[model samples]
Target: MPAKSEAQQMAAGAALAAKRGEKKVSELEGASKQMYESMDEKELEKMASTSQKDKPTHNRKS
Candidate 1:
């Protein structure tokens, strides 16, 4: 699924980087860390690729 907000997309991007070894998983924290652990590359790619235009910085619901 696509990211619901800019923050979610950012977190997914971080996680995707770690998944691809572009960034260390140790560099992740909070939602990014969780995503790295729980999501696969494709799922993260979908979320990270979601356009941030007109989206909120953060989703209100957890």
Candidate 2:
């Protein structure tokens, strides 16, 4: 998914790093860590809803 903000971009990068074993989730620091930790399920759902609205559709014909 395309990240909509700096925090989202950083979080995505961190998740990718963790998945590749380059870093542990516990190793996250600074804004990335704070943002990740601060999100609850409800907040996550709200973010997802807003992000979905911001996403572009790919079904258009040339």
Candidate 3:
């Protein structure tokens, strides 16, 4: 599924990089760290690939 916000998309990209060994997993923090641990490469890829054009910086809880 696509990410709900820009931050989520960015986190997914960070997590994806770690998963691919382009970045160290230890370097991830916050949502990026959690996603690196819980999501597979494919899942992270999907979320990370989402366009940020219309997404908000943060998704507000309603």
Candidate 4:
């Protein structure tokens, strides 16, 4: 199979982060909720990149 293009990967990552953020807002108890709610895609992508840098990789992981 072909690999995901950078744009596709970034978009998918941002979408996943946003969904996670929404769940976080409902699940977190305090300031963390507000923090996630306030983050835009650019910030979310940065956060996701930093958070995933050292993680293991696989086709299904992303």
TM-scores of the candidates are 0.95, 0.42, 0.96, 0.33
- Candidate that beats the other on TM-score, 1 or 3, i.e. the better one: 3
What shift in Å separates residue 20 of candidate 1 from its native position after superposition? 0.3
List model 4 lDDT by residue over 1-59, tens digit each: 12234433343454445456544334443433443566565655564454434333433
List, residue by residue over 1-62, the lDDT tens digit for candidate 3: 99999999999999999999999988999999999999999999999999999899999999
Candidate 4 regions exceeding 4 Å error are 1-24, 51-62
Better of 3 and 4 by TM-score: 3
The runs of at least 3 residues in candidate 1 whose Cα sits more than 4 Å from the true structure, single-residue gaps closed, are: none
* C-alpha lDDT score of every prediction, in listed order: 0.96, 0.53, 0.97, 0.44
lDDT at residue 29 of model 4 (Cα atoms): 37
| Better candidate by lDDT, 2 or 4 | 2
Candidate 1 per-residue C-alpha lDDT over 1-62 given as tens digits, one digit per residue, 9 for 90 to 100: 99999999999999999999999989999999999999999999999999999999988975
Cα error, candidate 2, residue 51 (Å): 16
Task: Point out the higher-scoring one by TM-score: 2 or 3.
Answer: 3
State how far residue 30 of model 1 sits from its true place (Å). 0.2
- Ordered from best to worst TM-score, the candidate numbers read 3, 1, 2, 4
Inter-residue clash pairs, candidate 3: none
